[model samples]
Target: MKFDFHSHILPGIDDGAKDIEESVKLLDDMAADGVDLVVATPHFYCMNMRIDRYLRHRNAAYEKLRPYLKPEHPRIILGGEILFDHSLVGNDKLPYLTMQNTDFLLLEMPYAKLDDQIIRGVEAIVEDRQVKVIIAHIERYLAFTSYKSLCELMNLDVLGQINAESLAHFGTRRNCFKLIEDGYVHIMGTDMHRIERGYASLGKGMDIIRKKFGNDILEEFERNGKMVLKNYSYEQIVG
Candidate 1:
């Protein structure tokens, strides 16, 4: 149940894995890192990318890697790291974009500013559509807002997904620890793109977690992920 819930492992669709070789390499890294499942979340900016075209590209890339998919490797689940836009407020297709058939959507919020309208848009998606949202790379958005703003955002019914790299590389571990200790962090993702230029680091990130936060922390993250995937009573964990 150790699921890497956000990644760009699909080849040539987005700025993730360049080719099938890189895709397999990323999968190998996931398997070595003890990830039992991975959600291949290529980037999707609704303002620009059309849904039909995105799906077609995604399926094509997925088909290319189908034969190589094996039980021993971390099983791939389809999802998208969607960049938030105001238009998503009432979009019916939003639910269809969730992780596999689950209700969890990996949402990458805007890095520009955290405004009331954007916050309401997120709430609308959850309340109106009944789709659970996981705010992707929560640490990345912290730079645009204050600690109070972050706490307020977490207070919403959605789950906050922090990037593994943020746990070590982003110089945000101190803040990440605060969020974790306060039960604000509900899940973790690698957000891995490529092997070169230091984008692939699922193994390295987990190593840091084990040394810094111990096994219990890792287990809790796994449990939360499993709960979401299984359609369990996620409210218990979210609160």
Candidate 2:
């Protein structure tokens, strides 16, 4: 099954699609692209959403989309692309917002650069508690430009998720290749906001993956993603 680990498909919750119709259009495109499952990761910015309010909105959106969802269609799972903040780590209620209530949390690091706090927060979530930390759109982390920090993050058992569009974008090719070569990237997400761009970007990335790594690697990515979606520990799979 092709499972997209990150997306902003929920309407009006964050910076994703504006309404349900747009959300459905994106889902339809995903289905056409052979995406079997998508984790509906609405943004959870630090300064914005409260835990209770976020859940309330997420649940309501899930219900609203249910009748339109077909079992045969690509499945939409619940999750959030949580912006990394110290407050989220200590919050007991935060884990419920993860995909299927899984221990795996899709975290978005700051866009500018890596900092001590980001490292500490990742350590708290993954190393200290042994939770699965899937770093969302890791290609955007400018710190990756420094090989040392990228290596440090890789050593922490954090899985890197690359955005499809980034791979297609100029200047990011080298970084994307390096991540794939270093085995840092574990999954690819469309991160689609607009309908026209979503599936096409994913296709472009998949094409690159296929030409460079072959079908076997793509299958492995899909398998790993399914394991994540099922809440299985990465250690179990790695072992």
Clashes of 2: 0
Residue 93 Cα positional deviation in candidate 1, in Å, after optimal superposition: 1.5
TM-score of 2: 0.91
Write one digit per residue (lDDT tens) for candidate 2, span 1-239: 67787888877777787888988888887877888888889888767768778888988987887777755667778888888888777667766767775788888877755666677777777755535788888777755446666567667877789988777866786788788888888888988876755464566788887887788877878877877877788786454
Using Cα atoms with residue i matched to residue i, what is each candidate's TM-score against the true structure? 0.92, 0.91
The window of 10 residues in a row where model 2 has the poorest summed lDDT is: 142-151
On lDDT, the candidate that comes out on top is 1
lDDT of 2: 0.77
User: Model 2, 205: alpha-carbon shift in Å?
Assistant: 1.4
